[model samples]
Target chain A: EAAVTQSPRNKVAVTGGKVTLSCNQTNNHNNMYWYRQDTGHGLRLIHYSYGAGSTEKGDIPDGYKASRPSQENFSLILELATPSQTSVYFCASGLWGGANTLYFGAGTRLSVL
Target chain B: AQSVTQPDARVTVSEGASLQLRCKYSYSGTPYLFWYVQYPRQGLQLLLKYYSGDPVVQGVNGFEAEFSKSNSSFHLRKASVHWSDSAVYFCVLSLSNNRIFFGDGTQLVVKP
Candidate 1:
C-alpha cells in the first residue's frame, strides 16, 4: 500500500509569520505535490516537485514555495503567512511511471490569523 | 489545459437506493479520468479510474463508473449506498507530469 504522511496537522500562525508544512511518503514515488482545498473549489495545486532539487510551479504557487531535499520528503513553505493563505493543505505522491498513480496524505489544516 | 466539471454540488439519497453523480470533463484526445472520495477532513480516496479499453469500471464499496466519449462524461454509480457513503466526491483529469485537474467535489449525503 502507498502512504503519505504530513506533519503539523493543525497549524495557526499570525500574519507575516513563516510556516513550513512537512510531508513524507513511503511509496518512494518520484513526484510530489502540494494542494489546497476550499469550499466551492476543488483541490488546487500549489506546487510540485519532480525529484530532489527540482521544484516546479503549479496553478497557484504565488504565496508559497516547495522543497524536495530527498526522495521521501517534500515540503511546502509560506514565507510570510496571511489570513487569505489559510486553508487545508494536502500532499500527494505519484509513481514515476505507469499512469502516474497518486497517493495522498491525510492533510494539514492551517490557519493564518 | 485539461479541466473537469462536476455539475452537482450536493446530492441526497436514501439507504439501499441507487445513486449516480454526474461528472463532465473538457480535454483533448484520450484523457485520464478518475473519481475519488473524501470523508470529512480526510484525504481523497481513489474510487475508480479509466485510461482505456472498457468504458465502464468498477471500484471499491460497490461503486462503479461509465465513461462516455461522446458525452465527455464519467458518471459514478452505486448499486446500494450505505450511510458511510456520505462524503465529498471529486472527478479529476490528468495526462502526464503528475499534474491533474480536479472539479469542485459533489457532496453526497446518504440519509439512513
Candidate 2:
C-alpha cells in the first residue's frame, strides 16, 4: 500500500500568520497533490507537482504556494493565513498514468483565528 | 466546462438495505470516472474507477459502479449496507490532462 504522511495533524494560526503543511510519500510516486476540503465545495485542488522541483496550479491556487523539494516531500504554503483558509487539508500521491488512483494522507485540520 | 456532479447531498438507508449514489459528469468524450470514499477525519480512498471496457466496474468492499455514457452517469451501488459504510462518497473525473475534478460528495448514513 502507498503511504502518505502529513505533519501537524491540527494547527491554529492567527490571522496574517504564515502556515506550512508538509506531506511526504514513501511510494516514490511522481505526482503529488494538495487539496482543501470544505462543506459544500468538496475537495478543491490547490496545487500539484509532477515531480521534484515541479509545481503547478490547480483550480483554486490563489492563496497557496507549493514546493516539491524532492520525490518524497511536498509542501503547501500559506503566506498569509486568513479565516477563510480554515479547513481540512489533504495530501495525495499517485502515478501519472494507468488508473491514477491516489493514495492520501490522514489530513490536517487548520483553524485560522 | 468539464465537471463532476453528485446530485444527492445525503442519503439514509437501513443497514441491510441496498444503496446507490448517483454521479454525473459533463465532458465531450469518455473520461476516467472514479468513486472515492472518505471516512471520518480521513482522506479520500478510491472505491472504484472506470476507464473503459465493461460499463459495470467492481470496487473494494463489495461496492460497484456502472457507467452510462448516454446518460453521462456513473452511479455506485452496493447490495447490502453496513453501519461502517457510512461516509462521504465523492465522484471524480480525470481528464486526459490528468486534472481531476470532484463533486460536492454524498454523505451516506447507514442506520443499524
Candidate 3:
C-alpha cells in the first residue's frame, strides 16, 4: 500500500489569515497534487508538482500556492483565507503518467471565517 | 482539454439490488478512465481503472466498470449492493501529463 500523510486534520482560520497544509508521502512518487473538495464542485485541482522544486497551477489556483521542497514533501499555502475557500483538501502522490494510480492522503478539513 | 461528467448527483437503492452509476468523458486523446470510492472523512480509493483492451474491468468489493469508446462512457456496475457499498463515487479521466480530472461525483445510498 502507498503511504501519504497529511498534517492538521482540521483547521479554522480567520479571513485574511495565512494557512498552510502539508503532505508527505513515502511512496517515492515523482508527481504530487493538491485538490479541494466542495459540495457541488467535487474535487478541483489547485496545484501540482512534477518533482522537487517544481510547482504548476491547476484548474483552481487563484488563492493557493504549492511547494515541493523534496520528492516526499509537498505543501499547499493560502496567503489570504476566505470563507469561500473553506473546504476539504486532499493530497495525492503518483508516478508521472496517466496509467499509474494515485495514492491519496486522508484529507484536511479547513474552515475560513 | 479533458473533462468528466457524472450526471446523477445521488442514487438510492435497496440492499441486494443491482446498481449502475453513469459516467461520461470528453477527450480526443486515448482516454484512461478510473472509478473511485470515498467514505466519510477519508480520501478517495481506486475502485477500478480502464487503460485499453478489454472494456469490462473488475474491481474490489464486487464493483466493476465497462468502458465504451463509442459512447465515451465508463459506467460502474454491481450485481448486488450491500449497505457497506454506500459512498460517493467519482469518475476520473487522466491525461498523459499526469493531470487527472474528476467528475462531480454520485452519492450512493443503500437501504437495508
Error of 2 at B23 (Å): 0.5
Q: Report the C-alpha lDDT of model 3 over A5-102, residue by residue, as the tens digit.
A: 99989999999999999999999999999999999999999999989999999989999999999999999999999999999999999998898888
lDDT of 2 by residue, B48-98 (tens): 999999999999999999999999999999999999999999999987778
Flag regions of model 1 displaced more than 4 Å. Answer: none
- In angstroms, the error of model 2 at B14 is 0.8
What's the candidate order when arranged by decreasing DockQ?
A: 3, 2, 1
State in Å the error of residue B105, model 2. Answer: 0.4
Model 2's DockQ score: 0.67
Per-residue lDDT of candidate 1, residues B1-112 (tens digit): 5788999999999999999999999877778888999999899989989898999999998999999999999999999999999999999888754558799999999998
Model 2 regions lying over 4 Å from their true place = none
Score candidate 1 by DockQ. 0.59
Fnat measured on candidate 2? 0.56
Q: Write the per-residue lDDT of candidate 2 for residues A29-108, one digit (tens) a residue.
A: 99999999999999999999999999999888999999999999999999999999999999999999646899999999
TM-score for each prediction?
A: 0.97, 0.98, 0.98
lDDT, candidate 1, A1-113, per-residue tens:
99999998999999999999999999888889999998887899999888989999998999898999999999999999999999999999997643555799999999999
Consecutive 10-residue window with the lowest summed lDDT within model 2 chain B: B93-102
Model 2 earns a TM-score of 0.98
Instruction: Name the runs in model 3 displaced over 4 angstroms.
Output: none
